[model samples]
Target: MDIVEAVKTRRSIRRYEPRDVPKEIIVEILQLALNAPSAGNRQPWRIHVVRDYRLKELLTDAAGGQMFIMEAPWVICVVAVPEESASRYGERGRSLYCIQDTAALITHILLLARNYGLDTCWVGAFDEKKVAEVLNLPVGHRCVAIIPIGYAGEPRKDRPRKSLSEIAVFHE
Candidate 1:
């Protein structure tokens, strides 16, 4: 699908079917995710693909019983490696663009997945410590987002969004 079409149609999907996503498709999504731009070309992100049902259940608990985390066929944990930036840009880096870059990439991945006929919900509220433990995240890495992906269970209706004039400014 065209990028514009995908962006307009993509919505936060909360319900999913009980089918499994193909391995190749998952790989494709990850590939697109890594293509996201970063500061000074230093990509500092690691993704954890959680497919185990037991682990998914644990994630739901960590997310305060969002429940949909367990229903989706796949959950991905996006982790940011801040050290990658600190080593290159020094003290200025940690206070800089690493988090924003990682976030942009995740957003790109979600849009790409939506275009591929998959659905996702970006989960930002969760127990970081539990997520780190469950995903076995390495030291110095922070969990940035938890995304649930699968076939969307319900047809989407557009959510309320601000008008263009309200959010955008014209520069002369």
Candidate 2:
């Protein structure tokens, strides 16, 4: 699908079909997503691809019992290593640049999944400490987003969006 179509069609799919997404496809998506620009090419993100049922259950609990996380065959945890960017850009890199870079990467993953006829939800409501423990994250690594990816079992209605004029600023 084209970028415009992908953006328009992408939704926070909570219901998933009982089917599996090919491993290669998932890898390909991640590989392409890595191309997302980073602050000074530090690539402060680390992706944890979770397919184990037990781990998914743990993640569901960490996410305040978001059971849809278990329904999807795969859960991707986007980790941000602030130090990676901080090494070059100092405090601002740790506080902002890493987050901005990871957000870009997350957007790429979501749109790329849509291009593959898959659905995904960008889940951020979770216990950060619990997620870090569950995923065995390294020191200074933070879990920024938990994405559940799969084939959609239900249709999603479009959510309302603000008008361009309402959200955009003009200088010219």
Candidate 3:
């Protein structure tokens, strides 16, 4: 699907079919995510693709018992290493710039999943410390989000959204 269609149709898939998501597809999706712009090309994000059932359970527990994580065939943990970013903007680059860059990568992954006939849920409700421990993330890396990817088990309806006129303000 095209970008516009994908953006309109993509939804947080909570239920998934009992199927496997191949490593190659996951890698390609991650590669697309890496294509996102970063401050000074630091590329401070690290993606950990988890397919193990036990680790998935741990992630579900880390996410306050969100069972959909365990049900999905794959869970991608997006991590940000602030210290790895360029210090041109000083502390702001470490905190703000790196975080924004990582979030952009996550957005890319989500959209590309839809284009590839797959679905994912943006999970930011998890306990970061627990997630880091579960994934054994390297030092100075923080778990920004946990995305569960798979084929949808059921249909999803579009959620309510504010109109552009209501959200956007024009100064000129």
- Give the top-scoring candidate (TM-score): 2
Better of 1 and 3 by lDDT: 3
Ranking by lDDT: 2, 3, 1
Clashing pairs in 3: none
Which wins on lDDT, candidate 2 or candidate 3?
2
* Candidate lDDT values, in order: 0.88, 0.96, 0.90
List the candidate 2 regions with Cα displacement exceeding 4 Å.
none
What are the TM-scores, per candidate, against the unseen true structure?
0.95, 0.98, 0.96
Please give the lDDT score at residue 128 for candidate 1. 92
List candidate 3 segments past 4 Å from native: none
User: Candidate 1, after superposition: displacement of residue 65 in Å?
Assistant: 0.7
Residues 1-172, candidate 2: write the lDDT tens digits: 9999999999999999989999999999999999999989999999999999999999999999999999999999999999999999999999999999999999999999999999999999999999999999998999999999999988977999999999999999
Total clashes for model 1: 0
**Model 1 over residues 1-172: C-alpha lDDT tens digits?**
9999889989998899888889789899898778899999988788889899999998898899998889888898888888888889886666566788789888988998888899999999999999888888888788889999999988877999999999999999
Question: Best lDDT goes to which candidate?
Answer: 2
